[model samples]
Target: MEEWVIGPRLYNCYKCGNMICRHDDIVSKTFQEDRRLITGLHTVADVYCCDCGERLGWRYIKAYEEMYKYKEGKIVLEKFKLANENNW
Candidate 1:
């Protein structure tokens, strides 16, 4: 549940031709590249691959009010699940 799959991409690490699964904390690290508070709260980050240090993607951080939209899709996706979806 850590990595968001049903929302806009937070990571697009295809340079290594690899794909990351849910909540892949070990694969990437995001560092804020630019942040502006006076502009009504916004943040930009650079996501890098943890393995080969490749640039993955850029992330736009948002607060709860605006950020909740990104999560709404996940909640809806939860309604469709296999019986053994968590068997791993």
Candidate 2:
């Protein structure tokens, strides 16, 4: 018989292999334009990996719409800049 084990999925920095976050922590995966995300226009600042300084994505500074207010203090990580922990 074979046994399978499931572990917590994680996201790591593509360049430095430093642990960045967990897959479950993701809030949304929407396209970004200028300083806005697809859900609503927002003011954002670039987020970086503390260990490598690689540009990971951006943190929302402000959300213009009332419905998106919850996203104001959240962050969005670029999928391409992260590697699945299992891959490494």
Candidate 3:
């Protein structure tokens, strides 16, 4: 008999094919506020790709409102800049 195993799903940088993060690492999708969006204010830092230095997205450095405090220290990566490792 043969044994089989499965690996965790991975997402890679689309440009340089660098391993970015795992699918299970994603937290939420409704926490985005564009850097240029003026309706609300948030203090965030740009998140760059480690290998290629591509501007992948931003990290929530500070959230002004108490309700949004949970977003602090979280990062959001652009969907277009990610590729599933299995697709490679």
Candidate 4:
């Protein structure tokens, strides 16, 4: 299993002012092929606040000449917790 470092960078809810941990939150990644005759793989990361549960922004991972958008959502922490508890 691959592990990613959960940065200490704090994210606060705009409405509730609650601190959120990225490691314990949900993150979605989307990927698609460019419609144009481009040559590259494109991907986007949709980061959510997890506190107020609002979408933060769409971070482009793979850069390409044309733009291709696809949405993929997952509750990473919840899945991890469930896996740890042997739910799966």
Best by TM-score: 3
Worst 10 residues of 1 by lDDT: 75-84
Candidates ranked by TM-score: 3, 2, 4, 1
TM per candidate: 0.30, 0.74, 0.82, 0.31
Model 4 bad stretches (over 4 Å): 1-11, 20-42, 65-88
Off by over 4 Å in 2: 1-5, 29-41
User: Candidate 2, after superposition: displacement of residue 64 in Å?
Assistant: 2.8
- TM-score of model 4 (CA atoms): 0.31
Query: How many steric overlaps are in each model, in order?
Result: 1, 0, 0, 0
Candidate 2, 1-88: lDDT as tens digits: 9998888899999999999987777766565544435677788899999999999988889888999898788887877888988764
Query: What are the runs in model 3 whose C-alpha is more than 4 Å off?
Result: 1-5, 29-33, 37-39
lDDT for position 86 in model 4: 17
Residue range 1-88, candidate 4, lDDT tens digits:
9996644444354555555444234443232333342445645565665656666444555554443333223222222111121112
| Model 3 poorest ten-residue lDDT run | 31-40
Better of 1 and 4 by lDDT: 4
Q: For residue 70, give model 3's deviation from the true position in Å.
A: 0.9
- Cα lDDT of model 3 by residue, 1-80, tens digit: 99966788899999999999987889864556566745456788999989999999998888787777877898989888
Q: Which residue runs of candidate 1 sit more than 4 Å off their true CA positions?
A: 1-12, 22-41, 63-88
lDDT of 1 by residue, 1-88 (tens): 5884454232223445344334443232332232343334544455555655665544545434564435222211111111122233
